[model samples]
Target: MNLIFIDSIWFTFMLLPFLIFIARIADVTLDTLRIVFITKGNKIIAPILGFFQILIWLVAITRIMKDLDNITYYLAYAGGFATGNYIGLILEEKFALGIQMIRIVTQKDASSLISNLYEKGLHSTSVEAKSNQGKVHVIYLIVQRKMIQNIISLTNQYNPNAFYSIEDIRSVDVQSERINTKQKKYRHVGSEK
Candidate 1:
């Protein structure tokens, strides 16, 4: 009986650190994502993530408090935090949840680039502007974050030396006509049935 009791105690001591490590990683990852959502002005999802982040943190801290003398638990907690940050950044990159505004200025003729963008269904506006070097064409395009790479490729193909800058767009007001048209089509299909 004494041997069994000792074995159980040893098992628990070994298991608690691992469990704490996992919990810390989870909570920190959620925290990182929550910050991203907040910056992107995602009111609904940000609060939900924030709630869970704090809840998990409370649980992990409670365990640490319970065993103040455990060096292994502290190390696990710290290690988890470091690993969580790396994982969170990678996940955010994979998600690419937002829009970006890309501005391109080219000294060369921009007609071909503009035409290619229109052909690819990427809307852009071009303006004739003058620079110290002479005439320059400025093109402005707003696209989903994931589409930035494609835009870059098109720019490189058209004007490799074009000057371009990307800025994060917090929000965009899309025209309601597109949504209404889709709804009307759906209604028409349903009526036919």
Candidate 2:
């Protein structure tokens, strides 16, 4: 007697929007986590994220397929995608993974800070550049997330009025070379003997 195959409870259709919304949240969250894992070079977690991401995507698509005639289902599907992107970005910001290059510029020369950073086993490069005020010294360093605060503090201590910015670095190799300064320290992997 019933043309619609979905039985049990017709009222269950009412919950479709809520379910879709949650699915969207999960899908986006999965994507964000995947990116974070990849950026951090987490081989194990990346695969796990990919598995969950595709799984949620399939469930969302299946719901849409079953209720092709329902307009609310369509809305939920679209809304989920949009919300997922926003959620993914928010999650990425919360978890700052990956190598980052920090460029610190100060109105005054920060030779002391540079020396301190070198002693701490960090690589750096410095150059003279002109800012809105006058000539300033700019120091660049590529470091991991955990060392970000320490670098920032050194920047502040060296030059309070310095302008600085941090950005993600896609790749770097152990053999990479840097310009030499008196404070620079070279690391030896093993004994020369």
Best by lDDT: 1
For residue 21, model 2's alpha carbon misses the true position, in angstroms, by: 1.5
Please, what are the lDDT tens digits per residue for candidate 2 over residues 1-193?
4545436345445576669878977887788789778876788998998999889989988988877887877787788878888888877766656667889988776788777776666779889888788888888987665467767776777787778899877666746655222122432222121
Which residue pairs clash within candidate 2?
none
Superposed Cα deviation of residue 90, candidate 1 (Å):
0.7
TM-score of 1: 0.84
| Residue pairs with backbone overlap in model 1 | none
Question: What lDDT would each prediction earn against the true structure?
Answer: 0.80, 0.73
Across 51-137, the per-residue lDDT of candidate 1 in tens digits comes to 998998899899899879878889989988998898889899988878778999999999988877765656688899999999999
* Candidate 2 lDDT for residue 170: 64
